[model samples]
Target: MNHWLTAPILIPLLGGILQVFMGYAPISLRRTLAIATTVLTLVSTIVLLVLASDDAYRLYAFGNWQPPFGIVLVLDRLAALMLVLTAVLALFCHLFAIGGTDEGNRQFHSLFLFQLLGLNIAFLTGDLFNLFVAFEVLLIASYGLLMHGGGRARTVPGLHYVVLNLVGSAVFLIAVGMIYSVTGTLNMADLAQKIPTVTGENLSIVKAGGMMLLVVFALKAALIPLCFWLPKAYARATAPVAALFAVMTKVGVYAILRVFMLIFGNDAGTLANLGMDWLFPLALITLTMGVIGALGADNLKTLVAWQVIISVGTLLAPIALGSTAGISAALFYLLSSTWTVGGLFLVADMVAQQRGSAKDKIVTAPRMRNRTFLSVLFLLGAVAAAGLPPLSGFFAKLLILQSAMAGPQMAWLWSVILIGGFFTLIAYSRAGSIVFWRTVDGHIEEPKPLGGNVSTAAGALIALSVVMVVLAGPISEYTDATAAQLQNPDGYLNILNTPMVGEDG
Candidate 1:
């Protein structure tokens, strides 16, 4: 087994436990530990990504047990990509939190690390049961983080989030049970091989289970109809926590890509391309709804939260294509949008603090102290979020458009995406004008200074969007390869079926 395959999960697990024991330590000490551990995990994931670039599968089997029976962590291009993304996002969020957000609760550092643990596991786990476990772990941690500041505003939404996820968890378990009963194994590779052979009543059960899993992932992804909780929950969360959550919806997208493509993919016989037909149309509706929500948002945080939904819709549309080009475009867009939206959340918080009584509300207030700085960051984030040109968002949308050119839904995809971008630009423009441009003549409250750590954290995330534009060539190449890797499950299944040398079965 390659020991590095376990580092992403273990590092966060150990870090959270150590911080728990250090509960009495200075906040500085805890913060330092959390950041250090996250940085280390980031390094490990980068190494794994480099290794995975060779397109080899590396599996870490628990207790040297073989596949289908042992719990395994699989290192592949996609998993490595997500691990790196999570670590990078977490590190910045951690940096931003130490600027005083962490002080809201003594257990903030611990919960944050636990959240990473769950996210990493969700990306790396090789079986369905463990994926369900990973969802529970992350959702539990999220419940705490959502209500970190503790107010009626957060409490109501947090309760809603909790109840909904609990329902999702139960559904997840039922789906897993159905799949297991029908196939006799919860290992994804085993299921992929077994699903194609299922027939009769068993086939129907498997199909129902697969669809249930889709509903669960849809809820997690915050797709329309099930996404009402996100705007409130995310809008109310502390700045750093909300920023970290920018990647949370992507977790659902990742699960859909991994499970659907690998197990229920085109090769799954009777169940081939299952749930995809529903995914594309709903994704478009989700996109439209998100744009409408953004237009109506009365606060910066709520607008950014709606942007998250828009991104999910944007991402799933391509993924629903179930083609290499479409999946590749989604992956590229995923990176750009996640980082951009996260930066926007932090920017919103900073703006809220400066605006005093007005908070993040989309109304005029006294001119902010660092008007030029915050405005610039917000503009960059807005342009990216709105998919404007000369930035990563524009390129990402271009890729999605290009991918859909030959598809039957070309006209629909083109129309919705174009219209969505136009409306997004209008929404951000309106918010920017009201908040930054239409300032009151007199000050309602004193302007607050932006902290160095806070500003740097936010700026760095936004800067990453610029970097994505510069590195578009290499990044596009990587995403293309990753998408190809996803399309070919034979490479994954063969590796899992064969035991590592010297391993005892």
Candidate 2:
């Protein structure tokens, strides 16, 4: 039955429903339940990661139905890695929410669980239609969470966020329809097999569908022109929600890897390497724009939001290289970037609260409470985000550079990434000094104590980032193996051809 493969998604589903029923329960109880569920999810995901490390793939077929006929869940090293990363981030975010981010919000707990549910399913699902369904689930849950506090800051951005995604959703459906119409299949494995056989006009239709889907995924990933909605929407959301959203852009990156490499990869004959040429140029531009946005941001939260876009751009650039080494490096950077940004969001919120009326604005104002502690945290985060030496980001970026050097657009990629890092360091340094290095003065309010949960949450993330730095060797090896598996989809396709147990024989 391979229940562990499905547990990540189902546990959150049941937990969210249970939370909805307990709406009238004490906040303590609701939060306790959410934390426990997230903990269980983390535990389950860890177990699956261990299993996947030993075995390349695990499949779970619902209703015991056969391939291409019924829904199935596929868990590989990449999927397991994403699930574990998501669970860890969700646990910390839930703890931060417990520290009062969920106050005055009736459905925060349930929405949090549902968000996990959607993200889990998105990572686990093996079929195209189910992937779309997972996207909707997560997007709907995000809408509620984004508007949780209900302010003009949240409301105005939320509307833009909603409209942009709605348009993305429509484009997604059209892409799905075109692919299905041409290939006569929505199952990823089936499409992988059918795509290579497509020819002439049909191949063009399939290529159009594939390209359109990339556009939709690019929108989700906050790529360049489609990325304007991310900075404001993320900056305006409450800290906990924004922290949890650190993985949202990566979801789009994941989709691109899964669909392009698996369905429209080099083996797809006429469709071999369809989008790399276009993606490479766009990815470099995205990297440039993201760094510029960070430099010009008005506040710490806005800067962190821009960092998310920068991370996306950094990841996509390597991926556009279409080499296994590039993919492996992209995977490692994805892990480091998500944790660093999520932790920074929590820190930014704490800094804002302690700054009184100054909040998180870039201009110098009053000194902050826990300035020393927050300073250290921000310093570590900046080092990581900027890819400085002795941290995970440095190694991650180094690996990408090594990979890009072997690709055709090596010079352009190297120039953009290195230059982007320089500007990012400058921006973070500027913001940090303004926020944490203020002059000692009497007008500054007495430093208020941070919530126990807030400090604990932030500390946990910092520790994780350090751990990533410490364990770089093993993590890189794992991602290398994951990329190898993705490059050869034969095993994945073979399993899809096998009948599920209890299915008529």
lDDT of each: 0.92, 0.90
The residue-level lDDT of candidate 1 at 503 comes to 50
Candidate 1 Cα outliers beyond 4 Å, as residue runs: 501-505
What does the lDDT read for residue 111 in candidate 1?
A: 95
Candidate 2 wrong stretches, greater than 4 Å: 406-408, 446-448, 503-505
**How badly does each model clash, as a count of residue pairs?**
0, 0
Model 1, position 89, has a per-residue lDDT of 92
With a 3 Å backbone cut-off (N, CA, C), the pairs that clash in candidate 2 are none
Question: How do the residues 95-199 of candidate 2 rate in per-residue lDDT, one tens digit apiece?
Answer: 989998898977899999999999999999999999999999999999999999998989999999999999999999999999999888899988989998998
Residue 244, candidate 2: alpha-carbon lDDT: 96
- Taking all chains together, the TM-score of candidate 2 against the true structure is 0.98
Over the stretch 471-493, how does candidate 1's per-residue lDDT look in tens digits? Answer: 99999999999999999999889
